[model samples]
Target: MNDPSGPDRPPAARPRVRSDLDGLPLFRGRAAQSGMIRLDCNESPLAPPAAVQAALTGAVQGLNRYPDNAAADLTARLAERHGVPPAALSLGPGSVGLCAQLIQIACAAGDEVLIPWRSFEVYPSLAGTAGAVVRRVPLTAGHALDLPAMAAAITDRTRLVFVCSPNNPTGTSVSRADVERFLAAVPPDVLVVLDEAYAEFTGRQADPLDGFALVREQLRQGRTNVVALRTFSKAYGLAGLRIGYCLSAPPVAELLGRVAVPYAVGTLAQRAAAAALECEPEVRERCRHLVEERERVRAALLDSGWDVPVSGANFLWLPAGPAAEPLAAHCREQRILVKAFVGEGVRVTVGTAAENDAFLAAASRFARTEAAAPVRSAALG
Candidate 1:
């Protein structure tokens, strides 16, 4: 049945690629600094270690050939380092990609995902792009994960819940007890994702439910919804390699592996990641320095009259809220660049001790000026 205007019929409305992405750079909101005291992105300040550098020198010979489609060596290294089976892991360009894949596995169009307000900003956006409705739960006064409210927000539509421990921009986490209670309250079919990118920096020996342990625990309890994610980008200083992973039940792992882009972790990344896994001493020392600097920097800021939480990650969170833009601008002018959230707060990654000193100095000046302005206004009144 050919219609008169069949050839001229309007093309069907094409859905834009992935719903929300408009060919925009994902990290567009974060300010960039070509060279400055960079405290914005939570990236390691140092270059790759000598061992990693040597490995890269060796890996250059293979760039011409296709990378390992399976990223087999890195997967085995990840499993061995974390004490999980290689079959339980799925790799990606970064944890963000892994999160996207997890959302794909867990949610159907219009299904809902739960994300925390003061946590990683990408959560809601990624979930939305995956055809899921994003459910945002605000943080508690202490800036910690609000488990009770999050649990209440859960409805039949909910499918995935992302828990970013030492949560980005906020720097707090759910306690072990809280995690257990939250798990108990959540339904079995719903996927719970625990992102532990900052886990290595924590000084404490026991983290209530280590994501690695949760995978095995969930299995022992006949559950299939828990997943733990980690990355070598932070402590290992491999941010440029774009390698990260999620651990799940073997079935879920299989699904994630199938959905992820083949060879997402390039051959170089695989080799470097494998080598990094064995350099525990180096990684641990760097993290220790970060933790120490986090304390020193936080103390310096507080002593100089800045309200901030003691961080468990490699960064500090300042409730700059309305002060964010100005503070960031001020820091940039002083040759330092720190993280800022429009109406939320600011996050400052711990750089080298000297770099941290420079940032603190800039902040002190900002705080002093702010302090004197009110007094001067009062005098005029």
Candidate 2:
């Protein structure tokens, strides 16, 4: 069979990927499309604000020219919002993109990057790509990140730690006190990234813990290693545009900028993000609406006997354990898509009212079907 194309048929052997990558899984999630209620990616179910739409419309005319590589306007607007100097900001294609760049800036081969297990799916693979070894500490019994365990795992090799507050999938946030203690315990040389991609949702909470404020306070107290990550993708409804930025000490922000790809944040994305910021009050109101919907959805699930977490983000986590896949499949059959971790759980983003109602109906059906099924041992007997 090989002889049919001669000795060169196979071409040169493709260069092998790094050995460390052999078993690591890549980031996998559902993409946006028409005619489906996408509750898998934790995206905002709302449309972008009017101002953002207008900005993007105008930005299209500027496509002939290169985007502002520095993204100065967006950065300055974000700086003012976060009460940081413009020099303390760095923009990227997305917060996840910045996560990869941050690893590159702070880590080398054999350096350690620590993150919580069952957190954002991107951290492990991205850190690996940056030549850093990843260490995953398990979440606590309550499904919150085990910050104490993470602090205990830090070694001389540990150069970076990611704290995904209102963590993905599980949707639980770490308390400010806990994070502050964890930061205090860790070596000052190690960078602690407080990823607050879902911070806006927490504002309506009974006792709000602001990740940006936490970072600012720590920096004010002279802890320069802490950084806060945010995005326009969630609350701002700009997931399609892929714009996010980080707030950090000036020196660290400079390093982050160095690793950034030139023109990574396009003109449309930058303008849209800036415009989104201008609609902060409106955005907060949208977040509050989502929060209300989230609580309602969780209550319905709880009433239905499903164990759901208290989500700080605009999603619900159903720890279905071995039944996770079956439940997810059931939802798919009903035309609803949710993110499922095989053998662990399902994460369903809170969608519009009608979408949530449809999902609830499907969930009810699934529960009924499960209840009506015969017990395995009894049936066998």
Candidate 3:
């Protein structure tokens, strides 16, 4: 119930907005600039492939026409690709946007939504919008979602649980076995949202769980509470277009559609996403390169004396403890921007080779400064 807007609201404007809206935390990544290496947001370093570019250009000609609110082409394509009926799919502006809609579909005032702390930054805001109580379960010591703990935290009021696999920022993925165990323990009526936004980058990791596959299996078994959320933002490089989809039981998918805004997804996004699907080989290649860069960057960070986690996504977690902000500041000073969680840690995205090298240089400088500061203070003492 903490206010994201703090206590500075003008008295006149306070009553105009819902109490819940007054304190909703907004994402605050730094603006992109020329010559700056953005290692903050977990976005793909590559642009959409030539096919998408062509589709986008052609699609621009139809700007005067309204978009397909159903997102027919994209949804059908996704359904066909995943071998699921179109009824089980729900499309939206992006996975984050769909997360909000899903919350609206399942939760009401006084309900509760359980989320892993330090997972996706948007979870709290999404829950808050629905006037749901936010329950943040802390991650395990290994920076993984403690599924057992999360299951333990559930109550009669818990209506939804968000499980971000290959979890954002932390970059640790949940295995199929772990997910199976967690699902078995949770209440069958309570919806579990498995966010696999980073799944494409997780293929090289050990036994990465296919979230949609799990959802489909659950649906086949008549378990309708599981939903899988995915996006074209990361691996597909369609962040600007804002296209994402959800796989769920037909009933849940229907509810999601009810809460979604009509024509929210633009035409360009749908066309681009379909075109991106057509260029699957290109997407796979980009992911392959990013995974390689992720390993190289992670190894470099570890060698540099940082406690970088073994990541299954396109980013690395530097658990800098108290030095998190200081290190982030140092990186920014070196013209590199990384996502910092204040006292928690920093999430550095794996950009292109040159961008990664730039971040490495910044990190090296920060390490040297940190190393020398204590010695200098001791000498003075």
Q: After superposing candidate 1, which stretches have Cα over 4 Å from the reference?
A: 1-26, 29-32, 205-209, 371-381
Candidate 3 lDDT over 1-381, as tens digits, reads 646567854444434568667788986756758888888888888878988999999999899999988888888899999999999998888999899998898899989999998899989988998899999999988899999999999999999999998988899988999999999999998999999999899956566799988998998899999999999999998887888899999988888888889888999999999999999998999999999899998888777667777788889998776677888888888888898897788899999999999999888887778533432343245
| Best by the lDDT measure | 3
TM-score between model 2 and native: 0.93
The positional error of residue 169 in candidate 1, measured at the CA in angstroms, is 0.9
Off by over 4 Å in 3: 1-15, 371-381
Candidate no. 1 TM-score? 0.90
**Residue 191 lDDT (model 3):** 94
Q: Candidate 2's residue-wise lDDT over 215-305, tens digit each?
A: 7887789889888899989999999999988888989989988888888999999999988889989998898999999999999988877
Model 1 lDDT per residue over 103-125, tens place: 99889888999988878978877
Cα-based lDDT at residue 70, candidate 2: 91
Model 3 TM-score, all chains together: 0.93
- Model 1: how far residue 227 lies from native, Å: 0.3
